[model samples]
Target: MKKDYYEVLGVGRSATKDEIKKAYRKLAVQFHPDKNPDNKDAEEHFKEVNEAYEALSNDDKRRRYDQFGHAGVGSSAASGSGGQYGGASDFSDIFSAVNDMFGGGRSRAGGGAPFGFEEFFGGGGGARKGRASAGIQGTDLKIRLKLTLEEIAKGVDKTLKIKKQVACKECNGSGSKSGATESCKTCNGTGEVRQAQKTMFGQFVNIAACPTCGGEGRIIKDRCTSCYGEGIKLGEVTVKVTVPAGVQDGNYLTLRGQGNTGPRGGAAGDLIVVLEEIPHDLFSRNGDDVVYTLAVSFPDLVLGTKVDVPTLDGAVKLTIPPSTQPETMLRIPGYGIGHLRGSSRGDQYVKVNVYVPKDLSHQDKELLKELKKSQGISPDAHNDPHAKSFFEKARDIFS
Candidate 1:
């Protein structure tokens, strides 16, 4: 059974575009397959999130879904089962949109076969229609890489070890021992067989890939020993990825031709690297800007001091001006994260948090009493119109 789109995303029916995007991003990061490897439940949740976002993110689909529910949205992305919809064409449109969003589109290098779900389900065929009978492209793979604030602030290189299909070294992906094969009698080297049936409407012809020889159009006398007859073998492969600086969490990088090798020496798929930013101990990210809270004592605020502030680059000296009020926000220009695609750097904001001593020493108490006397602030100064209010007095402490 299909779940409601809003329910799947944990959003309200009245959610706006931004809210919908934020909710989807949060869920995508949490339930992403890379983050929860070997967990089927997480994978299911990831699909559910994708299905919900695909429906609600679009204005037309959202309107249809709001009125007619899942049936209104046509095919759910999670199931990819071309159920009853407005028409047969809707299935392709829905899945195509989803595939593009999930990094399953055509190869980034251009003129390559698709790794979309349509191809996997015998719809798009990955390769061009005429060439699909000759070559089958490999499946795309996704993995998550966690980066610290320091690494993200500056671009870093990463090495990943993954087990994926590669062309068998022995047979050179020909699937035959001596690289020799004979045409199949079933399809007569056409790679497809035709079946004719009589229906109520008229005669119907069904064209399907030949089962014998598995659509290769030829039979191998001696199959490859390394990869059996599949022409591919699973092996551990090392892939190097260059992560650009300022890449936000949940954003992904695409490495062309680094995924599983295609069957029968077809084009290899892409490797999608989704980045996860590890939380920083002292800094919080807001876009490219970094937020930091600096605690200062009353004397430090009054006397001013040079303090060390932590930034992605390193610790730097920040000057606190004399008589600086609490909650003063100081901007350190160009100390935050760099632009992902540009050279501009964001600023770091230091918010001052005043700290008060709860337990005063005996001499401190006496000094405070003397200071109050000198300032002419009586114990009953609350009734004085010129006196500071409770809020004003506590501003530094609460700010």
Candidate 2:
């Protein structure tokens, strides 16, 4: 039996559009083919999630599915077999949706392929037309960008050198030495050729890009010597990228039309910048906030003293109150990383630890022995009602 659309998406039947979209995004990311490479189970789950979202995202399809279950949304309504639910056509929509979720900018142009799936799915070679006729889109490029805590606290701009396919300068991307071409004999200027395939269900007609002209409908009579008639060459270019503040690891920013240029003046591809957070020497990140450990002398903790605390910006003075306990956390407002959205910044947490000397001089031992003779100086004699246990302090730090 087919799984329920709501069940496949892990949502209730009455889920709102926003709720459905949120669930779909979570599931899509979890089971994305890129994240779970070579995992057949995850790939199936991804397709299922896309199928469920497709049926639920649209109000009309959702209403029909709700009234008549699988029959209403299936290929032929009468068959109720769902043959077209997970077909090649749906993959395009699935990729487009994923791109919208992670693209972080403008939508792709009309004829552009999403995530360069054409190479994987044979350019949607099943009944889908017009795309083969249109100019082929260039493949997207992905690069990892490492940022430090300081850089993440305040956004930064970086220039990256990328090597990719650029349009040939000799023939101006036309692939012809004389800048002239003729219509393809195979596809006859249609850019696609049709073929018949026998399947278990029935005979199916498949449409694919023409092999002669590579879907361009035209062929170069005289090939360009520079690019060997491919209309592109591998070259290097510098791209300026502005990384936003508070971007966590695994997060990515998309630069539209900044990837490899399309072959023969087709649509350009996108540049995907994946952010990687470099480990900090003195601090660790917790969500938007940063945690830092401060080591102070025993006297500073007991007698109370102002000490310098390291922040992303610089060192700031932190006042320790009298009788401050060890493992106590202090907060410095607006000293941490900024929020990804909005103007607010997270507070930096300073965890206090008493610094103990590994080796002490005879004079230091004599002074310590003298202080131990005083009342309330010994651990057994020290009794504070407000003092927390070691475990309690550890829990408070995480909380």
Q: Best-fitting candidate, measured by lDDT? A: 2
lDDT of each: 0.75, 0.78
The reply for model 1, stretches above 4 Å from the true place, is: 1-128, 132-134, 197-200, 358-399
Residue 131 in candidate 2 has what lDDT?
52
lDDT of 1 at 105: 44
Candidates in order, TM-scores: namely 0.61, 0.63
Q: Which pairs clash in model 2? A: none
Error of 1 at 219 (Å): 3.5
Kindly list the per-residue Cα lDDT of model 2 for residues 160-231, writing each as its tens digit.
999988888998876679888888899898777876655443333446678887777878879999988877
Cα error, residue 341 of model 1, in Å, equals: 2.7
For model 1, give the 10-residue run with minimal summed lDDT: 81-90
Residue 358, candidate 1: how far off, in angstroms?
Answer: 4.8
Quote the positional error of residue 217 for candidate 1 in Å: 2.6
- Per-residue lDDT tens digits for candidate 1, residues 182-257, read 8989989777766564433233344556778556677775988877867778988998889888998899998888
